[model samples]
Target: MREALIVWGGWPGHEPEQCAAIVAGMLRDEGFQVHLDNSTRAFASPQLSTMSLVVPIFTMSKIEKDEVSNLSKAVREGTGLAGFHGGMGDAFRDAVEYQFMCGGQWVAHPGNIIDYRVTVTRPDDPVMQGIGDFDYHSEQYYMHVDPSNEVLATTTFSGEHAPWIKGVVMPVVWKRRHGQGRVFYSSLGHVAKEFDVPQMRTILRRGMVWAARE
Candidate 1:
């Protein structure tokens, strides 16, 4: 069976633990042997490279240089990486290398919790197939993204909260690669309950599976 390691912990505001549980269950349902850890130290495990996938649920946390290095090396060597929201996007703020692997960083959520729309930009991609544009009620993440990322979904800023970005199209979901690894991310699921949203959950599910090492 494919194995997946999930490391969760950081700012409680994002309910990292709760979100991790939801993701763990999702992976288990998909036939993956899931392992969960509440500390970033798990990233340093020698076995990390053997796993099929790594999911980081840490938001705004500090990671040791060695831990980040090991995590990056594992992914670069072919272990897949997938995650959503601040857990992956806002994690390891001081680790620029980690940010580069993630393909984007969550810089702002203009109006905090508010309603927005998520538009599918790559419906033909396996991760987004059959998913249509949907209304989302959460932080419309304004991110600093990698230009090389294969953007799969996007959202337009209305300038209501951050006027300078009015009408600017921001990537909400994307998939990219780091060496032999597949990396996927989505700026949805501010909390565990967001998993109840079919679109959000389905997108995350498909993205995770798509990122797993074959």
Candidate 2:
């Protein structure tokens, strides 16, 4: 079976395990051998080299140096790395190296987490294909994104109360090429129920498929 590993922990508000399970099912449906571990300890093993993809469902927290290195190296060698919202971008907040690999960090969620719309930029992309436009009544994230990314979709800060240091247009779905590996991220997923949305499910699944080391 094709292998994919999901590492989940940190904030419980995001329902780490549930969200991981949702993604796990998506991966499994796409013919992957999925493993779900709600811990940061898995990063201690070089066993990661055997997996085709590594997904971090973690929130704002610090991770060990060796764990970070293991994950970073795995992705560099062409293994997939993908996640959404704080689970991916906001993970390992205190580590500079982790942030560097993640490509962006969640700075804030302005307007107290309201509904917003995300527009697909690269419609021809495999991950973004068929996902024209959709609205998410969830936390609209304001992030500090990396310039070296192929932004797939962006959402504007339509909420009036947002403290956006950046511009109105912010990216929600993006992909980056780091070394030989493909890194994909989305700034949605604040709620575990996000997985229940058909469009969101399709988008997340497509990303996983694109990121997998096929």
In terms of lDDT, which candidate is strongest?
1
Query: lDDT of candidate 2?
Result: 0.84
**Candidate no. 1 TM-score:** 0.99
TM, every model:
0.99, 0.95
TM-score, model 2 to reference: 0.95
Per-residue lDDT value at 72 in model 2 = 83
lDDT of 2 by residue, 1-214 (tens): 7799999989889888888888888888889999888778787678887788899999976789898888888888888888998899889888887788878999888776687888989999888777789888888888898998789899887547744343488888988877788888988788788887877777778887888788
Report backbone clashes per prediction.
Answer: 0, 0
lDDT of 1 at 203: 94
Provide the overall lDDT of each model, using Cα atoms, as 2-decimal numbers.
Answer: 0.95, 0.84
In candidate 2, what residue range of length 10 has the lowest lDDT sum?
Answer: 158-167
